[model samples]
Target: MVENMHERPGAPSAGDGLVRLYGPRFQSDPAAIYREIRREHGPVAPVLLEGDVPAWLVLGYREVHHVTSNPQIFGRDSRRWNAWKDIPADWALRPYAEYQPCSVFTEGEEHRRRGGALSDALAAVDQFELRNQVERIADQLIDTFAESGRADLMAQYALRLPVLAIARLFGLSEADAPSLAADIAASADEGEEAVRAHQRVVARMRRLVEEKQARPGADYPSRLLAHPAGLPPEEIPSDLFLTMGAAQLTTADWMGNTLRLMLTDDRFALNLSGGRRSVGQALNEVLWEETPTQNFVGRWVIQDTRLGGRHIRKGEVVVLGLAAANADSQVRPASYAHASGNQAYMSFSHGLHGCPQPAREIAEAIVQTAIEVLVDRLPDIVLAVPAHELEWRPSVWMRGLIALPAEFSPMYADRPAG
Candidate 1:
């Protein structure tokens, strides 16, 4: 466990009242914590990252929208962050907070050019073909555990399906998909393993780019290389790495969280056994209630500004409270039922830096299909353990289950091939 901030010498004084964004309380039930923070500190509250680094957490819906919309004042460049000097070389969040040459950190026309190339590449993907690919992957995954009567869905299904589809989209072979998926999961974690895992992902992407350049195909990497943006060869790997990491983890959590909601919530219990009527509703509700991405290490202030009744200094970091924003009373409907069909939540952020339309479509297709296929294959599936007994991954950045143990009637009968 990380030592309490109060016990560390020279830490922000107790009177400062800056909340640590990590630790047990935040991981266990972040929604409750967000409400408490908003009650005491208003919308924009002072907070500490790992090592007690200072930053602001934007809790109000309007404040989050404003910050994401006004890119000129709040930039994407992490190099400008005032807290970089205080960050350790081996910071667990370095992969997200550090400046890299990818499209994620670029600004102005440069960003438009690189982002346009990405949008175009993703746009070229045939949605019909992608959906078919996801369905086939989903069926094959179910075949492995369909007869076991018990399985960990997180490791066995939700975690593996999206990466396999993404790897295929990138033109990687069947043998490489498993290792790539493992590396992506490890890279999202803390400590030395994450760092090394991230390096491996990048190296693999670099090799993929080289191979595509020599022998072009209908894959994402090939489309990127052939795009008219004239992106440099060296930079394509970083962009591909970012795309894979973002899609794999976020989509996996979307599936895992949706399954948890369906199995555990009384609202969706009627549809748990091969009912598709509530699948769309459950998927949308998860985005508003239990989004895969809880918080983001976000925009750096370009200059001093006043937001959400708080004074933010230039170069200070402002974490986007995406989950908090969705729960903001000002915009959130009084009841979950009322919030249906209202897709304005900040799960995907907003404006230039938000998830692109094509990427969102691909993710929705993969997640929706994965869930539908699972329910269809194992109509009698039920949670092996009580919902409350299930543990969440202990990370501030991502919200997902550590495991989703489930049980169903064993089936030894032969199944039709997809």
Candidate 2:
């Protein structure tokens, strides 16, 4: 058992056998760690967050599904967590575990009101227009380094595109998009500046809400303002902030991971150009394997319950092992070949709290269009470094490449657009 540095007397401790979710090994190869935990602890394993904070990792597909589906028992409210007293204000993971006024923490009818408004707002998005906007942004991003013949696609393209596109959707002006994008990126990092960055995001969203209220437009924020659900003015910004943060990072990582799969795997690499069919396969494969959201600080146990043959006490934290559940032998495909076209992966999560369908469609449109446009523009692009040399960002919750350096024949910025 790892020493529980934060454990206090009478506070719950998952006795002696908790796997630390942080450290170099978990950062480098989390799948291996998950497998080891599953072998030793079965479907549900006791785990420690950063700072020796104890929690349970649901490692089985069925267990994850059960937990997510039964939110009544495994609530979304993080206030129910028993370890809050042990956590410091500056804890890197606090942004996720702390309670907020957003829809993500709301339960029952409240969630329906907030979440429904968001869904309806998102559903109003013009997919065709969104795709066009994404393509234009992708091309502009590619143009930045196209003439250099080498570029880190992860930073230069994948990371920037989603936020910029989302900014437009929020009705933010062109001048504000870059700053919003940068703030969203910084807020996702587990750094000292994250809290301030998050504050800036909220401020920006609040301003956008005010603008939409005064001058409605055919945009997401405007739609939310007009929704019949009548979400409170103060509550709108929090929800909008949550929506932007969630959509931007997840979609960015989705693009980055899919690109990594295509560049690294021989099956996809062999037929890169004009392989629209292969692109779809790569996207689906990444969701099942390298899903952007690896482990979500998830459902809090509402009461004592037995899950995966282990007794969980009331008010305990239950981390949703999304990547692990996707890799579960019982549900996952034996091989990548068999995994093609299978969309049953819990990458987007499950149950009422699952990512809204409209949001998912918007993310897909952005990811698919961005990838297809890149391939169409630079048909011969290949990794500038060896496939094994690529590094993933050191984050336990999100899975994405640190940088994807690629080289291709030079295309001048002023050259005719593909």
TM-score of each: 0.93, 0.93
lDDT of 1 at 350: 93
CA RMSD (A), model 1: 5.0
lDDT of 2 by residue, 214-311 (tens): 89998888888788998887788988888988898899999999988888877786234545668888999999989999989888899987787777
Q: State each candidate's clash count.
A: 0, 0
> What is candidate 1's lDDT per residue for 196-230, written digit by digit as tens?
88889999999999999999999999999998999
TM-score of 2: 0.93
Instruction: Give all candidates' CA lDDT scores.
Output: 0.86, 0.85
- Least accurate 10 contiguous residues by lDDT in model 2: 1-10
**Model 1 — TM-score against the truth?**
0.93
- lDDT over C-alpha atoms for residue 152 of model 2: 93
Least accurate 10 contiguous residues by lDDT in model 1: 1-10
